[model samples]
Target: MPAPCHRTPSIKMVRGDITEQSVDAIVNAANSSLLGGGGVDGAIHRKGGSAVLAECRALRAAHYGRGLPTGQAVATTAGRLPARWVIHTVGPVHSRTEDRSTLLAACHTNSLRVADSLGAATVAFPAISTGIFHWPITDAAPIAIAAVLDTPTSVQEVRFVLFDDAAYEVFTQTWREWKQ
Candidate 1:
């Protein structure tokens, strides 16, 4: 049997790949180009099929070169996953000069804004920038959690789906502290 719904405006952290998750929507850490690339981008594209790319192509044609400033987001159909929508947000790559915290916060905020625009009640998020972007899971977790908690939307549930044990542990530990 399925687990009971907690029925609260709370964030839940779980260990798993975002592609395999069943939720209202999944957050895609996309490149500015919006084309499928490595890590979460590749996984979502691979599972969601070419249709997603086709749709993105259309969107890019209309909105390309406009520059979707960091932290802003757009939505498209899920294509293949059990979700109804895919919310794409751009995240920052770790660098010596960039404000990593601000960019990471933007990622989380933009995702929530997209979900809210779509009237989504639940959403799943991968640890943005924790992979190839190298934002460091330890730093990303708290910023992500804070962004989700800070959103004013009526979104009923938010999930942090970690791709590995280290990411999961970081999120779980941070969540524990945030709750108390």
Candidate 2:
């Protein structure tokens, strides 16, 4: 099969809370349950308000009864969030004996696809699977950047909203390396 045609978007990195990002959509590194869990998922749900949960529940009841699977994405109203929508994507748990890089890449690609479908021109993403999922930041950085760079989407900007200096540095360095 032919590889997908890639598009270049304005990629930026920031060290801050993702909930504070003012964009068209925020990508939540969510658990499969989609009800909310630790790390980025919990923060997004907490700040986004009950309206986000309500839509999640409705989605669960209407379609995702078994819960959202890893690497797939779904969208909900952002509620009180600065963004118009939240694209929830479940990333795979890292494994020492198994290579799950493809699933990690899928998380970013799927979220972008969801964002494009919603006509979101700018999107903010957290480091999916790098927290409690135990995926190393170094290993995850390339998969994420490559996925976002390679995917064809109408979105105009993609921001990596890192929670700390270390993650922000890693992503920044990766971006530099990719550009070279």
Candidate 3:
């Protein structure tokens, strides 16, 4: 028999690229510019094609100046992925001078908020700042899990799609412990 889904607040850890995960929505770790950049951003843009950029440009024009606040998310069509919506979430960069806990929480909270707002039953997330943003993988693992655990939403399934072995291991280990 398949394992039952864990009931307590816990994140489902899976090994794969976030861009390819099939879910109602996928969270993109976007820069403040929202123009798309390296790492997960580039992969999503490349897979979703120019249409994603066009939609982002339109959003940028409409929501000018404010950009997107950390922990808050905005939605756009998936363009090419299996998912129908792309939730853009801005995660904090690990600059030594910046306090990123709140922003990290925001990343988790806002993504869930957007998904719940759209009535998505399932969502996929990438390790937000563990890439180019320099957030340590070990440190980020729990924060991501905590955010997902804290979100109050109709979302029934959440997948943490990790791009590499180290990240995958961290999420898996943390999730296993959290589940137990």
Candidate 4:
């Protein structure tokens, strides 16, 4: 798919597949295992091919043996994917009993940090934990947008690549509210 338009104070919300985004980097909403699971993680691993998994395995062998911690991010080769790098971040699962908003926000903030370290000007991010992890899009949207906006980074473009209309609407609405 075509890359999203670049605008100053850049943040764009797109409804489509994250793997198709032709950006400098794409953020993977990965589980702690970082080995690959369902949802966005699986799609990225599949499309990015063995080179991606190979780097992930090397990461595990070298440093993340216990797996990546929640709210943390690590970068790997994008393999056959369009982007140069895949920033894999582990988002906290939603919990009714405990507030994990900070952890959720960390996923976005940390991913941006990694993207900046890689000198990636354009980055695409999925709504972290909003799928199998059960993070309600309503609550997740604002945090994701806020974290990206609040963080200091060199990234010129940030695209929240939502999987569906509902998520796209929520993120776009949240972004609009923030802009206003």
Query: Largest TM-score belongs to which candidate?
Result: 2
Q: lDDT of all the models against the reference?
A: 0.82, 0.94, 0.84, 0.91
After superposing candidate 3 on the true structure, give the runs of residues whose Cα lies further than 4 Å from its correct spot.
1-10
User: Please, what are the lDDT tens digits per residue for candidate 2 over residues 1-180?
Assistant: 233235688999999999999999999999888899899999999999999999999999999999999999999999999999999999999999999999999999999888888888899999999999999999999999999998998888999999999999999999999999
lDDT for predicted candidate 4 compared with the true structure: 0.91
What tens-digit string does per-residue lDDT give for candidate 1 at 71-135?
77888888998788888888888886767688789888778777777778889999988888888
Compared with the true structure, what per-residue lDDT tens digits does model 3 show for residues 1-180?
A: 223232433357788888888889999998877778899988998898888889999998898456777667898888998898999988888978877888888888888878777877789999998888899988898888887887666678889999889999998998777778
Model 4: how large is the Cα RMSD against the reference?
4.6
TM-score for all models, in order of appearance: 0.91, 0.96, 0.91, 0.95
Cα lDDT for residue 119, model 3?
A: 76
At residue 30, candidate 2 shows an lDDT of 94
Q: Flag regions of model 2 displaced more than 4 Å.
A: 1-6
Record all residue pairs in model 3 with backbone atoms less than 3 Å apart, i.e. clashing.
71-106
Number of clashes found in candidate 1: 0
Arranged by TM-score, best first: 2, 4, 1, 3
Model 1 lDDT, full chain set:
0.82
